[model samples]
Target chain A: MLRLIGIGLNPKKHMTLEALEKINDSDEIYLELYTSRIVDMTLDELENLINRKITLLDRKTIESEFLVERSRKMKVSLLVPGDPIIATTHIGLVISSIQNNVEYEIINGISVQCVVPSILGLQNYKFGRSVSIPFPEYDYYPESVYNFVLENRKLGLHTLVFLDLRESLEMSALMGIDILLKMESMYRKDAIDKNTIIAVISKAGSEKQRAIADKIERIKERDLGPTPHIMVIIGSLHYMELEALKKLASFPENENINLL
Target chain B: MLRLIGIGLNPKKHMTLEALEKINDSDEIYLELYTSRIVDMTLDELENLINRKITLLDRKTIESEFLVERSRKMKVSLLVPGDPIIATTHIGLVISSIQNNVEYEIINGISVQCVVPSILGLQNYKFGRSVSIPFPEYDYYPESVYNFVLENRKLGLHTLVFLDLRESLEMSALMGIDILLKMESMYRKDAIDKNTIIAVISKAGSEKQRAIADKIERIKERDLGPTPHIMVIIGSLHYMELEALKKLASFPENENINLL
Candidate 1:
């Protein structure tokens, strides 16, 4: 049997009891950190918390058939950061399990997508489709991310922007801000500008989590500690939502702003 | 201080360690079940698991100043059925905390929105804004829910439809199908029909959870056990997603399907 379990944000405290039980029952456990990083958690600390040896799987090993093959013979569990299967690559494993006739289960966890809205005092149903800002390389920047934001804005829904995380390279909120600004310059559609309001949440679901909502220019200058940050582009805001943003996210009061 | 803690779907096995610790440290722990129900677990079973007496709060009490007033003097935790703050009423508590000078923290959990996609092997990012179906009353049926599903479908995004749970009353999947059919007749947008493909997930995140995807007509005939059911209206499906649905969700192989 194979199980894809989510270890939420903080490995020390965010794992569900079912996740712990599954981890304990597995013959071999693997932890995948290429898709996301756990805040302030070392592999050794995680190993100690569960009191089991964990084999770290890189992207190549995870996507390969090694896990399926192992699960066919014995129990194997892959501990994912945040919710399992949110990353498309994990879906490949489920498909492989089916083809190989290896029974598999998905154990859910606290996702950043859900946590961000709760922490920011925003309604979850008010969020539109989430977008990811990939790290732009030479001649390889995709504008679909910007277009998705526009589509969400047009519907008066907030957009959760996921920063890029390619193996060892993690994108920070500052880097994401620069990418958005660059997109604005390239497209000139006025989708994003220094004056546009955005919320940058750092270390979400952790004790050190900090959220700051302000215009692009000032928000980019502020210090939102640590890695694994997600950004939210505000759309329409209700009066209570606006008040919560002001109190919880350090959003400045602007009398000219319109409310839904 | 007041902390809004999410017990996820099943209180027995879905809570994080942070949730347990906070519940233990809290001077007063309250569980609000009027919003949602815990599958196969009684209130006594939950109280026994936590080894503490829990005070139940209804909608009126939960929205009232009672919680904030008590938290002002001692530590208090409201054990929510799912991820805290998704209900919007809980956001009111956060706003009240700010007004009453009480510190608050949100401990995130595995929400149904995150869990349903994983169970069905659908990509989370492809889901648009979620909508809820209310129990239709005399002269008070809302077509906005139908419109939201149409909007999501236009974008080729999956719509997670929440079944209405009004205190002591729960709307089942059969009832939801009837309502959607009624909406289709009213709108004439061809949004939903007897042949439309939809997925119904019952008792999600629990041991007895079951998911089935098929034509709306056939799916409604099958027995999907218990309350707290959620429905997903299908959109464009990736080839792998279709394969996963077939293998995991009992979706039939249809040659006349389009893949993205």
Candidate 2:
């Protein structure tokens, strides 16, 4: 039997009561940190709370037949950062478990998906398709992020731009903005310009959560403080949304902010 | 200070450890039940766990100045089903709190938006705009729903059809499909037909959660059991998604389901 649980945004603040019980019941507990980071707790703190030695699984281990073998014989629980199935890879793993006739359960938790909008006091319905902005590999700069922004902007919907997190190196919002700016110049499309107001949110759903709303050009120079940052490209903002940004988050003075 | 907490889907299985602690620490605990229901636990069971009598607030009470007034001077925790800020009205309230200088904290939980996709093994990236189907109020069939389906289908994206949950009456998937069918006839846009494959999910994120995929006409005959039923309009499906529906969920035999 395999139990996949989401510990939510903050380890101390968000673990569900059922997740805690499952951690106790499982014969072996493994934390899959390759996908996302646990922003709050350390491995020692987590181990202390669970009262068990937790084995951390890298990508190689997770992709191997080790999890399947262990689950087939003993109760195994894999702890995910957010909701277990938010990532397509996790969904693929569950499908694999189904093929192996392994009984499994998914315990969902809070992801940056809804929490980011909630923290900013924006309507979830207004958010369109979310896209990830990865660190450009040699001669492989993806334009999916730019395309997603353009599509969302056309529908007057907000776009959630997730900066890529690779191992210990997480892409910064400044670099993400730089990529978009470069993409704009290369494509020569007016999807993202200097005047565009972008919201850079860091450590969302955590105690140190910070949000900054400013023009893209201006944001490229500003430090967003720490890793795990996401950007929201502004579409048509409601008056209340504008007000929420102004009151709760840092929004620069701009007369042309309300496109709605 | 006011803390708006989402108790997740199932009370017994989904409530977070932090949510429970906040419920105990709050000067006043109010359960907002107008937007969504707690499918697994009764009111008595919830109250028993909290060790405090919770006042259930109706729509009128929630919209009124009661919550804001109470939170102004005391620590109030409003227990909302699923994520606290998933609803737009909650965003409005939080904005009001900000205007009144009332400090508030939002605790995120497992939302149906992510959970449904996770349960059905549908890629979240493929989900387009989500729309709710309200019961027709005699000569008031919303063309917006028809338009949304057409738009989403054009983009090759799945649509999450949320059934309207009026005060005491929760609309089922069968009734929702009926509304969409009538709208299609009225608009004649070819958005959805009798042969359209829809995923009817009931009691989502619960232990007895059931998902059935079939043509609309066949789904209308079967009882999905209980309130809080949601439907997913299929778009392009990955091979793994088709396999998930066949193995994880109950789907009628269809060669056309694999759109990968």
Candidate 3:
């Protein structure tokens, strides 16, 4: 039987007991690192924690023929960061398992989309369509993200912007800031003004996770001190939300005046 | 200091180590049951597992004056099911804390939005705005939810429909199916016909969690035997997604023929 186990977003301890049990029960364990990464622990740490030698599966190994065939014969546990099915690639694996007649089970994990709003003091229902800003390819970046944020602004909904990260390379919060800044400029010149509120959340689900709220320019200039960050550009704020932004996020005094 | 901690969508085990730590560190833990209920564990079960006594908070306690004053003087943790900020009431509390000058922190949790796509074989990025279908009020149900789903269909984006739950009741998968059936009639008479794929996810993030995909009418007729469920009305399906839906969701061959 094939198993899709969510290793969660933070570290080894973030995994559910049932997920851990499934990992221990599996004959072969494969870890996928492309979609999301564990911030607090290493492969060695996970190995030690789970007491099993795990084979690290990159995108190629997962999509390859050998792994697919092997999964059918053995009880294999494919560990994914965050929830297993969040990425389309993993969904493809499940589909392949179906075609191959491999029985499988999926174990859920903590998702960053749920984590970001809580860390940033934004309402989840108030959020619009989430957009991921990937590295610009050949001076061609999608304006759909900008349009989404603008639409959210029109409806007074918050926008959660997930930044791009490569498996081999570390992508920092600065990348997210740069994308937001560019998007702001492309959408509206005064978008980064004092009245604007943006929350920079880094290392979410990790022990050292940091969430700070400020104007777009200030957030851009500030050092959030980590890779794997998400930004929330808030639109309309209720009286309580405005206050939470001020206290938890350190909203500026002048900004508070306008909000009040 | 006031802290809003998300216990995730399922059970006690779904919480991250950091979230667990925050819950342990708090002087008092208040759980708001009106907005959402934990499908996996009871308050007593959580108390025994976490080794802490949890105080239950109603809507009045969360919105009234006592919580604000109590939060300021003490380290308070407000426990929520799913992500803390997903519900409007939690956002109101965060705002209240800010207005009262209470220092606060948000401990993130896993949400169903991130979980649904993986299990149901839908694209996370291809989802439009999420809306809730409240129980009929004064013989007039809002068409806003229908419009949202219709718009999502037009845009080829999936719509996550949250079924209404009574404040004191446990809402399970069967309720979700009922809502889907209601929605199908409202949108299109033939919408509930065979080949119309709808995913009914119940007790997500918990060991007892279950997901099934079928026609809206069939799903409604079947006894799903659980609560706290959501419905996903799929739009355009990718090849892999379609396969996953068929394999993982147990779609009948006749249903596939209907789609063709």
Q: lDDT winner among the candidates?
A: 1
Per-residue lDDT of A101-216 in model 1, one digit per residue for the tens? 99998888888877888988998988999998888888566788888887788788899999998867779888888887887788777777666678888888677888988888
Candidate order, TM-score descending: 1, 2, 3
Q: Which stretch of 10 consecutive residues in model 3 chain A shows the poorest summed lDDT?
A: A251-260
lDDT of 3 by residue, B143-254 (tens): 6666666655655566787877786565455654565457667767343344456777776667776677776557666655467777777766776666667765665545
- Candidate 3 on A132-213: residue-level lDDT in tens? 7778768655777767666666656677777777866655666665665676767673434555677877777777877777
Report, for every candidate in turn, its global Cα lDDT versus the true structure: 0.86, 0.81, 0.71
Compared with the true structure, what per-residue lDDT tens digits does model 1 show for residues B86-124? Answer: 887899999999998998978787788878889899999
Clashes by residue pair, model 2: none
Candidate 3 residue-wise lDDT at B3: 83
* Cα RMSDs, all models: 1.6, 1.8, 4.3
Write model 2 residue lDDT over A52-161, tens digit each, in one string: 88999998888787887799989999999877886777777888888899888887777878688887877787777788887889856677667777777777778888
Instruction: Specify the CAPRI tier of model 3.
Output: medium
Report the CA-based lDDT of candidate 3 relative to the real structure: 0.71
Which whole-number lDDT from 0 to 100 does residue A123 have in model 2? 76
Best by TM-score: 1
